[model samples]
Target: MRVMKLNEVINITGLSRSSIYAYMAKGVFPKPIQLGPRAVAWVEEEIQGWLQVRLDERS
Candidate 1:
């Protein structure tokens, strides 16, 4: 399992930071794991799964 930071998430998903947070707010995206008071990261597998779902939907 791998943890990914916001910038990496942006690169992988091609989404801007605001869009990611907005999706999270709408309960449509994976929430990040809080690593520290000022640090957070998402599960890489979860993000990959999310991407797979999107790709599947496109088919």
Candidate 2:
């Protein structure tokens, strides 16, 4: 599975950094994995799945 940083997440989701954190806090977004003491990233497939769910919701 691919991992994506915050910048990529922002690009793919079109959400601001604050919004991303907000969603995470509300359990709406996927939780990120810790890459190191100061780095974190999300699973690419998970993000894609989340997008798919949103798309499905519009149907």
Candidate 3:
């Protein structure tokens, strides 16, 4: 259950900042697991699997 920060997610997903947040809001993506007062992270395995799913769909 590895976790990643927002910046790491951004670099990996290649999605814009707003788009990332929007996708989370729309439930199209996983919500962040709150860390401290101003920090958050997402499950790395979940995001990795999500990317794999999208790639599979495109193929």
Top model by TM-score, which number?
1
**Per-residue lDDT over 10-57 for candidate 3, one digit per residue giving the tens place of the 0 to 100 score:** 999999889998998898898889899998999998899889999999
Model 2 regions lying over 4 Å from their true place: none
Q: Per-residue error at 50 for model 2, in Å?
A: 0.5
Between candidates 1 and 2, the TM-score winner: 1
lDDT of 2 by residue, 1-59 (tens): 89999999999999999999999999999999999999999999999999999999999
State the C-alpha lDDT per candidate: 0.99, 0.97, 0.92
lDDT: worst 10-residue window of model 3: 23-32
Rank by lDDT (best first): 1, 2, 3
**Candidate 3 wrong stretches, greater than 4 Å:** none
TM-score of each: 0.99, 0.97, 0.90
Clashes of each: 0, 0, 0
* TM-score, cand. 1: 0.99
Model 1 root-mean-square deviation: 0.3
